[model samples]
Target: MNSMDVVRVLARYRFSYTNEISLQDQIEAVFKYNQIPYKREHRLSDSDIVDFYIDGVAIEIKIKGHPVAVYQQCVRYGSHDSVKEVLLVSAKNFALPDVIGSKPAYVYFLSAL
Candidate 1:
């Protein structure tokens, strides 16, 4: 699926996460429910490991932490050759640029869903 398709699929999910791990589990369920193919803990490099991967999109799940750190992490993920975009799933809302390293970046806020 494309970036927007991924976002729409995730937006339909009703998140009930208590932590990062739970959020990941909920995301996995959403993918399964939608019959979307994905990989968990996909390693982009020695230092970059994404929470999930679908097609050319790298998915990251974050329940807490600094937004800059998350953005930096997504930027690193976007640099990978296999990734065409980055999808950030967070429990809270934060500003993230639409593009990072020429790859599109999209965010799905759990609270907004």
Candidate 2:
């Protein structure tokens, strides 16, 4: 599906959660609706985990204005040897540097990239 379709799905999920849904859940719901296969990382003590992994690509979903720590954590995960790519899907527009068109580990905005 196109990027706008992805954004629409995320917006729907955002509206469904009145009490603040986890970022991972929001991302997973979008992938689920699109039938994109993915696996969720599990952790007992962590408040955040890489939202989804699909075909070795780790995607971290965040709403606009999420803390800097969240972005850093996603960057860390994306830098791992096991991760082929890392994508940051944001709810609002933001600037991102070019990644040489790499398959994974590059950040992307939901509506723009």
Candidate 3:
């Protein structure tokens, strides 16, 4: 499948359970399915604590609500050269507030970024 198709397939995996599966876990599963080489967080610096670190890319996933603290954490953790990219994965209707600056980023809905 193409990249878009792959993203769509990944989007469908999002579902709410009593015990919710984390966004990093879901993204890791997708990466595994696609045979994408990745390494989870193996370091514990102040700026290294996040959901997942795939191929040195720091990804912070959020659900529907806009948590200011979480967004700030992602920005701070992602502000390093070791981090290739900082991505915010969210549900279809997730709205971010204006406090966060316009940085290099991507948003994925039920479709590709």
Candidate 4:
């Protein structure tokens, strides 16, 4: 599928009613609901394992506080050859970092999700 398809699946999760649950688990349920197969803790490389691998995109969840450290993770995952894009999801809203470089990276704040 395409990136927009992934976006739609994520958007569906935003309107879901699973409160007090982790965004990571909510994302998984979204995939299951959409019948979109995904891998959890996917091994991108020997040194890296992302939270979720949906199609060619690497989705890393960071709910618990948005720190600059999370962006560091997005960059690291974006660098992997196996991943064509990276989506950084967080419970707290955070602005994308400047100089995140030319990677197909996107950020989502889960407060509305």
Question: Which model scores highest in lDDT?
Answer: 1
**Where does the lowest 10-residue lDDT sum fall in candidate 1?**
9-18
| TM-score of model 2 (CA atoms) | 0.55
- Where does model 1 exceed 4 Å of error? none
lDDT of 2: 0.54
Candidate 3: 10-residue stretch with minimal lDDT: 95-104
Better-scoring candidate (TM-score), 1 or 3: 1
TM-score of every model? 0.93, 0.55, 0.60, 0.78
Give per-residue CA lDDT, model 2, range 1-113, as digits (tens): 33334445555544333222455565676778878666777331244456666665665665665446655666566555556655667655544433413433344444422
Question: On lDDT, who's better, 1 or 3?
Answer: 1
- Which candidate model has the greater lDDT, 2 or 4? 4
Q: Candidate 4 — which residues are off by over 4 angstroms?
A: 14-21, 97-101
Task: Supply candidate 3's per-residue lDDT for 52.
Answer: 57
Per-residue lDDT value at 1 in model 4: 57
> What value of lDDT does candidate 1 attain over all alpha carbons?
0.85
How would you order the candidates by TM-score, starting with the best?
1, 4, 3, 2
Runs in model 3 deviating more than 4 A are 1-23, 42-44, 64-66, 92-103, 110-113
lDDT score, candidate 3:
0.54
The whole-model lDDT of each prediction reads 0.85, 0.54, 0.54, 0.71
Q: Residue 18 error for model 4, in Å? A: 10
Question: What is candidate 3's lDDT per residue for 3-111, written digit by digit as tens?
Answer: 2343465666654422214555667777798776666653537646656566555555565545666666666755666665555566544444422333344445533
